[model samples]
Target: MKQIGVLLSKNYKLLSVAAILEVFETVNKFYATAGDELPFELNLLASHETIENQKESFGYQLQSIKDVKQLDLILIPAFTSDNMHETLQANRLCVPHLISQYNNGASIGTFCTGAFLLGASGLLNGKIATTHVDASDGFAIAFPEVNLKADRTVTQDGRLYTSGGATSSFHLLLHLVQEFCGNEMAIKIAKVFAIDMDRDKQSYFSTFQPSRNHNDELVASAQQKIESNYHDVTTIEELIKDIPSSRRNIVRRFKQVTGITPIEYLQQTRIAAAKKLLERTGQQMTEIIFNSGYSDPKAFRKVFKKSVGMTPSQYREKFQVR
Candidate 1:
């Protein structure tokens, strides 16, 4: 049996761990039911301290990272905490272990924010990866060397794999199955799990929540202006008219603090407003477009489609209140 090690990282999400174990266990059971040898041995790997505390709770053989010298595959579960920086720090013990295992030819797959822990190991440097859609901005800012493809449902760079938020994890798992077993086994798993294998871009599921964790008052002032006036203007000059800082300074500091340019921020704010209206209102398309500060229907449709992966009518048809 090929060895599969699932790292129970600090603040690891219970559902993520459960899903990883269940999928592989099901795969193993499939072979056993067919009178063939089991294909995988699932190993719960964690730090020594965590192993002692969670061993009995997991009710499975838990191995410390120090004892796991070789693994054919490694799975990292998403973290529960919102502060991924602190969570990553808590899981620093896994960093060296991840690097060593990858060097030994073990493939690594990370689910949701679990990519943060893997990215911390420096193996993701220059590799395209995706994380939870909401965490994209933070991921990009934290690991500038890594190519962050926030819209992709899954990304594979050589042996390293990363998936987007939540249910997106299953797609990555199915992909691994395809890689190790075959496409037929992957299809069987998808059928058993009732997973729609058609998913690709994750953009449609994302809500544009701009960051508010910075202390720059000037940037704050610019943000307030943009949020308050996003519905009435298009140009950055018009949006930041009341802000005392020069346009150049505000743009630099705003991007520095928010990881997006002022124009991009304004577009996101407008799109957010439009999304809310689409979800909660019976407003006409024309009125919705006008209220969201777009003068041209074509431009609004273009931006909305690019940002949301659907047309305005399609978005409203799927999400509008009855």
Candidate 2:
């Protein structure tokens, strides 16, 4: 069994810690039955036993971690702070013990602003990590040694796993559980949580947001329309007309901001919409495809499999109308 450690700090947001705790605890319950065996062990690590309260966002207290050495995976939960020093104080032991843990082959992980603490620890030098977009500048200025990718929800460099924000913590944990336990357990947990079960290491991060500018206003407008009306049947030419920009300019700026062409983005959005419909509606595959802006069943199946690792029928069988 993999030994998991959650490093709780003073002022750490309650939901972040609670979410991680609840998920893992539920996983542990799977093993309580006579025929089931769990794949993980978890512990909460804190610097002190002074009866500290959790961060304001969620109301909870945490257990102190007395022995950091035996942990197989160490997770740092997100906390909000404008001042970097204040954030560090609650979980400062992470910095002093990180290198030693790495040398001994322990996996390091974090969620949201937890990446900021990893950066300060000097353990993330040259590693790819992500934090909240607002923390991007401060993280870069504080830890130029680490390569920060502001847009991603989760990034891994070797054994280090860093996540972006609050909700993304579920994705990060599920990914780790998948890595250590198996895909079956991941699917079971996801179904229990009513999650789409489509997330992977790369599937969940938001790449970039289209910026508003005079030159890119038309492109931004088109993107906004697409997002707002993802269920609507929108073609490339129609999108350009709505934006009032030339096809060339719209494509250029849209790709510049979001790292994909306009058509690609539309297809992605449609697939996302289809996933939601699959979870929420009892619609047939053909109807779901049409509603998600696809005209051909074969083509929709191909695209769904390519983007989400499962065919429409397979997705429905596994997750929808269940």
Candidate 3:
């Protein structure tokens, strides 16, 4: 049996931890009923002997292993924190243990913001990983060496694996099941859990909000203008007219500060506006297209699909407020 350790840390997302545990346990029960041997020995490992919910009112306790070595796979569930830096610093105790486990040939997998801990352990260095879309900008800034594939729902590089936001953890667990157990068993588990087996990307769920945390005032001003005037055919030349820098210099600086070209930013802004309109309003396609500053139906459809991983109609069907 493959030894699997699920790290239970303070401030961890309770539902994710519970879901993962329940899934593996159910699989074990399935194997027993079928007269087959267990495929995995799942354990809850932690830096502490006991972990309490940060919300003391909940009064829940988690029993954890003192030592987490000699594991085939280590799963880190997402932690709840607004400040990624502070979260990583507070969880520093797990860093050395995670590094040691990785060096010993154990694979590491993380769900949602738990990728921050994996990144802090230095295992994600130069490896493609992902996290919650809202946290993508922070993750990229915190770990520049790790290739952040924020659009992907799940990313597996050699022994390292990372999954996107919230319920995407189910997909990651399903993936692990498929890898360790056979396809037939994976399907059985999926049917048992009622998890969609075809979710492969997070692009449909992510909103493309350009990062504006940098100190570039010009870029910030340009972003504000684009956001407010996305319906207008605002050109880069028009944006740079009031700024002191040359068009080329402004474009270069904007790209440096925001990681996206001026045109790309505008496209994202328009798409974001279009998404909101589609979600809340009963606007026709022509009206939404015009309101989103797009005149050509073909061009709008192409950009919408490229950015959203689905057509406008599909996005509305999935996310529109009923």
lDDT of each: 0.90, 0.72, 0.84
Model 2, 143-189: lDDT tens digits are: 77788876565678999998767667887888877887689888888
- Candidate 3 local accuracy as lDDT? 0.84
Quality of model 2 by C-alpha lDDT? 0.72
Q: Give the TM-score of candidate 3.
A: 0.90
- Give the alpha carbon lDDT tens digit for every residue of 45-152 in model 3: 655634443222122333343454488998999988877778787778878888888889999999999999999888889999999987887788788899999888
Q: Which of 2 and 3 is ahead in lDDT?
A: 3
Q: Mind sharing the TM-score for model 1? A: 0.97
- Model 2 segments beyond 4 Å from truth? 49-69, 199-322
Q: Order the numbered candidates by lDDT, best leading.
A: 1, 3, 2
Q: Give every collision pair in model 1.
A: none
**Candidate 3: 10-residue stretch with minimal lDDT:** 53-62
